[model samples]
Target: MTKKKLNFCFKGSRDYIHGTDIFNELKNCFNDSLNYENTMLDLSFHGIAKKKLDIVEDNATDAKVVVKFYDTNDDKKTYYLVENKDDIVCRYDYAENKIVELSKIDLDLGKINLNKDTSYSLIENIVALNKSLLENMFKEAFGKWYFTRLQLKKIPLNYYLIRLEFKSNFNFKLTKTEIFLDNESLGFIYFSLV
Candidate 1:
């Protein structure tokens, strides 16, 4: 089979989605068999997730995260992030089919607005919401995990806002992604990045 790679960004906004929501969406993409029973589509979130450092509290917060996803069964996928010497980063291990936990995420507390009280409240609320969502999905799916893939019908032009399209072979659709500078969400793209 021919292979391809594409990066996904959120449709719009600099805001971050809670880690729980990310995990849930990821679970749906993995567990959904669509109508094709006996097909185990192992899905994983591939991107950069930073763990922020708070020396005073001695705890880490899930900070800015940018991820693209793909089926672990696909051998041609990869993700790269510019590592910061100061902060701890967590990433997915596609080849081994497991999450690589971060030792710690350290950041300059003053640099990120998450240091503000109101902003921190919002972040906490979102994280709570994400956790609830993930728990529900896990219960409903009986702990099964699946990932989404792109089913492209045509070669996309490298023009403005190029999109790779495909149908979801799972029970879930209407997916969302992160928005980054100079990138647009092409709906959904299958395959993986090398």
Candidate 2:
């Protein structure tokens, strides 16, 4: 008898599909076969900066939200950030299926003018609008596990990033799932089980 191998891959996106719509796209990626054994899941968002802010001081030309994973023999930590085009976010050795190096860059919040009235309003609205759907997605993906922390960062006139960390009920370790949003509205959601 021969064993069969399964390959899971999903890439999708659309305009005017922000909050729950994006969540639904993710939910459908697995086609009702999401593996609950994975211990952690991280979601990163990348989008165009709204025109209302002053972003010239930062000297940033292009930006994207990316999640870099550091996988050690013992543990793994997910680092999510909005990266400028000049920055080297991380190095991946596809043959080994792990990240070789991760370079961290701290954003100069002082240089960019973050309008108090509108800072993070986009992400805040998306999160607020899809809170329940996110909760349900977490439950469906992790079973007894729950999300431990959520982080949101706004890059004035560039991009924004969101990170969601999930906690497992048991101590077992496995490859974590990562979802990357390549663009804000006309975005591409890339899901990888590894």
Candidate 3:
């Protein structure tokens, strides 16, 4: 049986829609499947994921993510790349490249209920937000995550910005990624460093 890799898709985004990060995650997972050196890696995020797995690799460049994905059928695939390190989300487009895919994303803590109160520190707030996000996604998907990489440019940030990437286990990218969120969750905010 093929194993399922991790995927990203859940609730808590005002502008809820599948972003590029998910695409890149899926792209890397696909690549790993194509090149399997370890038989012990019987399971990789190959397709339809509900679990999350982090695949770290070497010699990866802006053209490819340093991570790989494993699927439920024990198959592996997916690739990733980042236009800039500050970019948070990844995108995918199979027709654009070979083996792996790429994308760039920026996350903004835009107008939300983050609060003007000094009760929380900046780093604390960011980490807390990250924790909440991780919890929310895992809760909904049963801790599963399947993503792919694409070439989606971010909306552009006002000040400075950051970015990240991921890949999937598909030769071709998926149809779409849909995100959902509440207003206070700050899930709708989107931006890029450019």
RMSD of 2: 21.1
In terms of TM-score, which candidate is stronger, 2 or 3? 2
Candidate 3 lDDT, 40-134, residue by residue in tens:
11111123222233333322343223233343455544333322223224333222111011212222421112323223222223323332333
Q: Is candidate 2 or candidate 3 better by lDDT?
A: 3
Clashes of each: 14, 0, 95
Backbone clash pairs in model 2 (N, Cα, C under 3 Å; residues 3+ apart or in different chains), count:
0
Which window of ten consecutive residues has the lowest lDDT sum in model 1?
96-105
C-alpha lDDT of all candidate models, in order: 0.26, 0.26, 0.28
> In model 2, how large is the Cα lDDT of residue 179?
18
Best by lDDT: 3
Arranged by TM-score with the best first, the candidates are 2, 1, 3
lDDT of 2: 0.26
Q: After superposition, how far is residue 177 of candidate 1 from its true place, in Å?
A: 12
Shift of residue 183 alpha carbon in model 3, Å: 11
